[model samples]
Target: MDTALQTKPCRFGDKNTSDIVICLKNREGIPKRFYSHSSVLINKSKYFANRLSHPGSNNCIDIYCSEVNYDHHVNLLRLLDLPTDSILDSFDSVKSAVGILQLAVFFQCEEIACCCIQYLEAVPWEDKEEELILKAVSKLGPKAMPILARIQPVDLAATKDVFISAVRIATSIAGPCPPFGNELKTSAQEQVEFMLGEDEDAPLVTADEEVKSVLRMGLSQIYSSFEKELSSLLLEPDLVSERAEEKILHSLCDLEWMCNILGKMDLMKDFVSNWAESSSNVLGVVENNKLDSFMWGLKIKLIEITAKVLEAVGYGNVILPTPIRLTLLKTWLPYIRKMKPLLDSKGSQETGFPYKMSEDLCQSIEGAMVTLVLALPSNDQADILADWMGAEQVRYPDLSEAFEVWCFRTKSAKRRLVEGLDGAGNATVSL
Candidate 1:
């Protein structure tokens, strides 16, 4: 560890009062020399004891360090003289403690290492500091297990339990949410999203069949509540109950949130199926009612959800029977086409709460509708394209792609049929 250096004199103990000079050397510039007591060094650090045990004429120890770790090495040497309880007090933050812990581990100074660990384990860390702590402690092995315990992977059952609890709180929509309940639900919902999210690592919850089943159960309850609200609203379409309207809005919001979760888990098939099956009834409730300004938000929310369902079906992400697919389009397409101009008109007005549609959303809805139309049987495509061609407001959905495809297919149908008939007639002579 010995290296020749242009030394700067610093003393942990008084000059000439100590027999040993500890030289801390960095790769560049002048190395620092700390005047210290042999008694304190040998008793505190095993690394020092082993080095000092071998007799030499000049009692000096050289320790080489990187520029980044030079200050930590100096602080650790100073901390060696402090009492065990007071040693932890020197650590002002997790960053400082982590820097010291690395050298403490290398220097075989268990006391300082223990103090660093203690200080770190007791204090809170910023996100980056936590990553630094993990990197530092992971190199020190089992000796730093106390620090790692807090972040270590827990029992699978325990993790699933916590995830399930969060899901329950997030999706708890029975009667009415209390004033503070929304905040709690929001927090839970955000955490549930985090657990299920994937960025640098895999999602926290494995989302096996059991987890998916739990999610499905929660979604079923939400859908049930939403259906009940819609059914009740339909019973008296003319009568406007603010309370009932609010409940219906909240339920739709819940369904919208569920779409995100279910989509991530690839469990959207059931949700999309349910939405598709109920599209007619859903449209009926909206169509029969006279929509006031207050109802525009509700209508917009329904359309937003329908857009996601449309995208899923459009991309063939969620496969459905042809009839259901046809029904879904038939049920919602007219309403969507009608609502666009109304929403735009309302949005342009100087209202307190304007109902605006974003360009991206409009494009997405248009693209999805086009894809959905193209996915249908040729006759169904022809029917949709015919309707789209004749409609007064055909600019929104713009089913030209489907129309062109139908036209090309329709034009070639006769030639393909005649070719098939000629082949059949030619084969008849041999038979």
Candidate 2:
């Protein structure tokens, strides 16, 4: 130890060499001591400099005063005594840092807040939580507004309003407001006039350019485009006005095309798996009930996307083989089955949240899911439909709806009964 210490250099505030204690209170109001040095704390954090300036700031045991809970404050103080080069590398670290940042802002520690702001601008977040962090950072004064231009779509996926606000502030330009309702108002007379007139030379936009613009958009814009299109279709009395969520659906179509073109089905599978996990539920920035929206969870998006992609009759421009198509369908069953209660007539009445998809939406979604099932290769269709109610864990089968879907879509509904799932004759399959 003597030889190694003498041979190598040590950075500032190496561990265990402490002179003062930073005290944080536990839930029971007992003080816990975290080691720190006056020089490092004063130099790195201005709050510590002011707090330690007066001799009375310390208790009899060299414990400097603090009121923030030990859970949130310990890491912030500990970081001060460590080398500055250490980076927070995970999503949870960023989430915790956001909490600690509140403390930093409270104590007038501009330096610590600046570090966190920089970290947040560069990190990938939980998509739904970016607004909370951005809102907090905006209150920190003028120095932090530039981060809006740097916020990626992944950070603003669920909150494009925040992203657009940041862009407007950073660029100092106002864009046109989006009109109400999902569809664009169109005129056939104007289209004819424009097609025949000299305006043809006025920089006509190409399909390639249009698609590039869509691609450049972050997740927020893509989702908005999709959702808007979806609304337009749903609002129309004609159930077939157009495809729903085209931008998202096609952006994914483009991915599927690339995956097939490159022969990377395994990679696509892995990507969807990760996408499914991160987007499993619509979690809010600080909500504790993480899976509160299970019926309309992130998995719903996957299911809808799969239904869009699996249709051999659509203008997808890419044809996924039956097996590949089946993989996408199977991936979403576990998630959709979780919504079985909400799908059942008795269970649907029991739902608490009002925003649950309407009866029309439920029917539309079920119709699409059933269509995708029936579109499966003749041999795979029955198995695919049956798997929705069957999983490793034993739960009450909601084949009630699944059976209803089969009855609606197939001629063999009476012959192919959803029986023997629970090994009891009490398990009935009536459509």
- Winning candidate number (lDDT): 1
Instruction: Give the winner by TM-score.
Output: 1
lDDT of 1 by residue, 97-197 (tens): 89999888888899899888888888888888888898888877787888888888888889899888878878883433687687878887899888888
Q: Look at candidate 1 and give me any clashing residue pairs.
A: none
lDDT of 1 at 416: 97
**TM-score against truth, every candidate:** 0.82, 0.33
RMSD of each: 5.8, 24.3
Q: How many backbone clashes does candidate 2 have?
A: 1
Model 1 clash tally?
Answer: 0
**What local lDDT score does residue 169 receive in model 1, on the 0 to 100 scale?**
76
lDDT of 2 by residue, 297-410 (tens): 332444444433333212223445565556655654555555445445434566563333345545544555555565666558668655655665424323355456556656
Please give the distance, in angstroms, between residue 174's alpha carbon in candidate 2 and its true position after superposition: 28
Model 2, 358: alpha-carbon shift in Å? 15
In TM-score terms, candidate 1 sits at: 0.82
